[model samples]
Target: METLKIIKIGGKIINDTVALQQFIEDLSKLKGLKILVHGGGNLASETSKQLGIKIEKVDGRRLTDQKTLDVVTMVYAGKLNKTIVAALQAKGCNSLGLTGADGNLIQSYKRPVTSIDYGFVGDIIQVNTSLIEILLKEEIVPVFCALTHDKQGQLLNTNADTIASELAVALASSFSVELYYCFEKKGVLSDMTNDNSVIETLDLEAYHTLFQQGKIADGMLPKLDNCFNALNNKVFKVCIGNPKMIVDSNSIYTTLQL
Candidate 1:
């Protein structure tokens, strides 16, 4: 099986031009099939605030109201998506920016109101793996944004981590997938305040201990879940680290194993 590298980049890197550019440059050098998924919540929230759309979250997941949906759709699918594609293009990577709506690549259902009505927020139901296979076979790098559709003409605000994990899981049968989650922190930290406090190797037991001790919370909580889910579903490798770790073999980063 050929190797596939699925990279999910978020946090400060999404908004910081220098970091994003550096990431694309590194991405251009990666071998075999590659995919890029991005999160631009910081930028989305800023844009929403400027537009007077109230932003809300429940347990690190966004509560996407109608107004917030419009903001995120425009920000995630439009601005951030194209920006990534264009950057990769300049770096000599043939990148194709896509949302779940594009070619029905991902199908999801909206969250039903339970304790919270997450508005247009979606939980992925299916991924069209054949389309991805076609793209990768054609040597077209797919750049995905955090947006999905119901196949009913409604765009939903989906989580980028979820998208990346689902894609990795789906592609596992045909490819040796390496799932990379690049974020602001170098890796899972032993101390939150210390940026250099990287926990290089993390397994489920250690993760549970830290999690129960409340070492991990907020966005990281679900993000870690996604990482484990991918590993369990046969993703060949899962790494959480700074952007440069994607290119640097000896770089300090968190390596997750079951």
Candidate 2:
């Protein structure tokens, strides 16, 4: 069985073209990696603000109203997706850009917000791995944006981490795939104020403790949740670490053990 690697690149690192290109160059060297999922939330937010748009969030998740959804769709599916595909192509990697809506690769429903509705925000409920399997069998890497689709055939904004987790679950179930969630931060830290306070590894039990103790909050909370979700779904290995440290197994980061 050929091995596949599903990597999700952080939005912050995607902004640096030099770094992004270098990352692709590194990935191209890997023999059988199948897919890469990327996010551009920071860039999208900045662009929205420039266009005089206000971003609303609840519990660290973006509330994608119709207006904000338009901006994000352009940034994630249009600009960022193409940029990544081109970068990988320049590095000699065959890449195809896609979103959840393409072939309904990932199916989702509108996330219900009590008392207020986030127009186009969604919670991913299903992922169709058949399309990815075909692409991988052809040795073509599928680069995914975090955009999903609702049952009504409308595009919906989703968290990139959630998208990656769903994809990881689907791919791992059908193939040998390693899931890596790369971020700008070094890893999950025991103490957010200290860079050296990184937790080297975590298990399902430990993760629950951290969450219950209020140790993980804000952005880190969702990321950790995604990691656990992937692990629970039988992904062989899931790592949360810096993008530059991806090639180094010894580099400090949290590896979620199944």
Candidate 3:
């Protein structure tokens, strides 16, 4: 099987033009099949504030009420996806910007009401692996935004990290899938205050320990969850780190192993 890399990038990197450009250049150097998934949470929040929409979150997952959902759709599926695709095109990597609604790439339903209602947030149900494979065979990179839809015509906000993980798991049988969660930090940090405190390797036990101790909280929580899910489901490898890890073999990064 050929190797496939699914990279998820978010946080400040998505909003920083220079950093995004650098990431695109690095990603262009990576050989073999690859997919890019991104989140524009910061930009979405900023846009929301500008439009006077209240932002709400519980444990790093946004509560996508109707108006907020509209903003995220525009910022995520519109601006960020196209910008990344245009950059890849400039680098000579033919790319297509997509949402879950596009080509029925992903199908999800609105999260059910539980302890707290998540409104229009989505829980992914399916990934169209055959569609992905066809794009890969055609040498077109798929750039995904954190937006999914119900087949009934409702768009829902989804987490990019989970999207990347699920895509890796879905395609694992056909390829040696490597899932990557890249952001501003070098890697998962032992000390949130210290940028240099990267844990080079993390397994399930260590993740549980840190999570219990509250060392890993907020946004990093869901990301780590997706990492383990990918590993447990047959993904060949999973890494959480700076985007440079894509191009640099020895870059400081956290490797996740089951």
Candidate 4:
């Protein structure tokens, strides 16, 4: 079995171009990792705000209106995506930039509208891993943006965490892979404020307790959900931590246990 790793870099880290460049340098030295999924939410939101577009959030998830979606696509798929790809290439890593629209890599359905329409928001329906396999066979890392196409042929913005989870499940089923959800946090902390008290492992029961205690709120909620989802789908392992910690196994990071 070939070893593969699907890493999802958080938007906050992507916004810091220096961090992204360093991350690429670290990744280039890894021999067998096949793909990377990147988020551009922070950049997208910032760009949208500068362009006079209001960003709406529903339950901690971005509510992508038409204008917001356009901005997101431009940032996630256009600027940030290419920048990462270029950075990796300069570091001697063969890389390709893509979105769900390319090769119809990800298929999605529009989110149902209620009080306020999530104009161009989507829920991922499927991922075509064939294209990814081809890229991996040639030792090219596929850098994906969290944008998908709806059933009606319109591009819709999807959650980057969701994209990473779905891609992890797909790749794990097809090959041996480790999925890492890298973010700004050191790890999932037992006490939200203390980085030293990071929870090294979480099982389903512990996750439920944390959620019930309201400790898991805001962004961490969806990230935790994605972690469990990947575990349920039988990915080899899932880790949540800062990007720098991912390169050091001795460094503490939250590990999801089945």
Which wins on lDDT, candidate 1 or candidate 4? 1
lDDT of each: 0.90, 0.83, 0.91, 0.84
Error of 4 at 230 (Å): 1.1
Count clashing residue pairs in model 1: 0
Q: Candidate 3: global Cα-lDDT?
A: 0.91
Using lDDT as the yardstick, the better of models 3 and 4 is 3
Ranking by TM-score: 1, 3, 4, 2
TM-score of each: 0.96, 0.93, 0.96, 0.95
Model 2 C-alpha lDDT per residue in residues 1-258, reported as the tens digit of each score? 457788899887788777787788878877776688998848899889999999887756677888898998899999999988987888889999998899889889987868777768888988988878888878899999989997577899888888988888888867776788887777887777787887888887887788788887578878878887888887888888887565766688888875
Residue 91, model 2: lDDT of 83
What tens digits encode model 1's per-residue C-alpha lDDT throughout 1-258? 999999999958978888888888999998889999998759899999999888887866678888998998888888899988988988889989999999999999998899888889888999998988898898999999999999999999888999999999999999999999999889999788788989999999999999888888566888899999999999999999898898999899999998
Angstrom error of the Cα, residue 246, model 3: value is 0.7
Q: Which of 2 and 3 is ahead in TM-score?
A: 3
User: Model 2 segments beyond 4 Å from truth?
Assistant: none
On residues 1-258, what C-alpha lDDT tens digit does candidate 3 reach at each position? 899999998868978889999999988888999999998858888899999999998865678999999999999988888989999999998989999999999999999999999999889999999999999999999999998999999999988888999999999999999998999899999989999999999999998999889898577887888999999999999999999999999899999988
